[model samples]
Target: MNGAVVEARNLTKRYRDVLALDDVSIRLSADRIYGLLGRNGAGKTTLMSVLTAQAFATSGDALVFGEEAYENDRVLSRVCFIRESQKYPDDFTAFHAFKAARLLFRNWDQAFAERLIGDFGLPVKRRIKKLSRGQLSAVGVIIGLASRAELTFFDEPYLGLDAVARQLFYDRLLEDFTDSPRTVVLSSHLIDEVANLLDHVIVIDQGRILIDAESDALRGSAATVVGPAPKVNEFVTGMKVLHREALGPLASVTVDETLSAAQRTGAARLGLEVAPVSLQQLVIRKTLINHPSRRVPGGDAELDSMEATR
Candidate 1:
């Protein structure tokens, strides 16, 4: 929990002709909540599986706590991976699952688990198969929150949950995290919802790293300027523009660099409005990641690429 809680070197997973992870290398910091974001089939789950040793990599290595995760009791016992669709045995009830959690995880908090169970309104005596989808998701969320592992990976663990329930999960997570700081990673397509929860972000696209940076830094890296076309052009000169929209004499452009105070003043003088882009829009405009990129750019991220790479 001091240094890198998880590290991968040239990690790759190939299922026949399909490439799941393409020589991806990353280091997860200790005691930080990281958002592992990407589109579907972007290898988010693949990366998690490799790191947690739930599945073997075709090539390269994954280390948990500076040691290989595969078959290492010392490492595995301290890690918890709750999948989006968790499967329990036919006979396993929610109570049975809790019992299993208590046996497997050394840091399992029964009282905390009970609280989460009540918060989620899970039926403890009912069979896992009999629970509704939201309740099923709650089972995973409950285990994940209560397990309190040194390294915990939640792979979209809130499917089938209503907006209110999802908000509850987020509130509970942040509240509990304040008391027990640990290495946590959340993989989700609900980017904006978890934007505030992330300390850092790592976006994967087509089995490759797209963007890896601190959340605040990432949020501050882009701005949208709207005004007369000429003034906008003059203000954004030499800056990277990710997207642009124009109507008659007016224009609005999304730029990769955060506006300096002087730049803001200049924009104000030019009658241009500079606005911060939302994390969702930032990711979308910055990467254009949702469309057409079969191969990952094998290079370091730069402001210039915020538009060009798309």
Candidate 2:
């Protein structure tokens, strides 16, 4: 509590020939929400695994509350990791699973869990194996929110949930976060969907840190300028252009720098439209243009097309 809630130093993990994580280092504080973002197989899961002690780091250190995380009950008991494919015993029902979670998590809030169950309309008596994928996701979401651990990680906990259910999860998360602040890390492919909720954004590509900055700073980090083709081209000549679109006499160019005050005024005078880049668009442009191969840390195949789009 006096220092970083979680810290990783040169954390590395290898699976045979593949390096799932490679010399990754990060420090996370308590009472903040962190967005753990990356395309599929970008080592997001592997990183989380090592941090939570679910898996060991190949050649680095992971400390939770200043102590090694692996098999450390003091740290593990205060952390809750809700995975997308969380499994419950075949004979257990949703209620039974909730009961088990309540017992495991020292900070579990029974009333909050009950309310989440009601909000998600989860069937308490239905066997875990009988629930649909979305329903199963709802169970994970419920536990993640109700656990109220000092540090909680939600790794795509709403994978099969519909838009409405997903929205509900976001709403509940935001509301609860405001009321009871804690360290929360959300790992998801729905970048745009959760962009607004994130206070900090961490982008990983090919097992490397691409960008880690305040959400607002990232939003204004770049801007797109649109104007007549020749004018736009000339204006962006010396700047780092992330993307471009041209149509006859019109062209739009996205650059990796904020325009200076004079430059902004000049663009306005020249009848050019300037707009801040969205987090999703910025991330897409960076991953696609900067690292086209999109390999993970160790030579994993590129993330699928759908993941790239996210």
- lDDT tens per residue, model 2, 150-254: 899999987889999999999999999999899999998889899999988888777777778888889788999999977776677667667778777898888
Clashing pairs in 2: none
Question: Per-residue lDDT tens digits of candidate 1, residues 146-241?
Answer: 999989999998899999999999999999899999989999889999999999999888798888899999887999999998888877777877
Local distance difference test values of all predictions, in order: 0.88, 0.86
TM-score for all predictions? 0.92, 0.92
Worst 10 residues of 1 by lDDT: 294-303
Residue pairs with backbone atoms closer than 3 Å in model 1 (clashes) = none
The number of clashing residue pairs in each candidate reads: 0, 0
Candidate 1 RMSD computed on C-alpha atoms after optimal superposition onto the true structure: 3.3
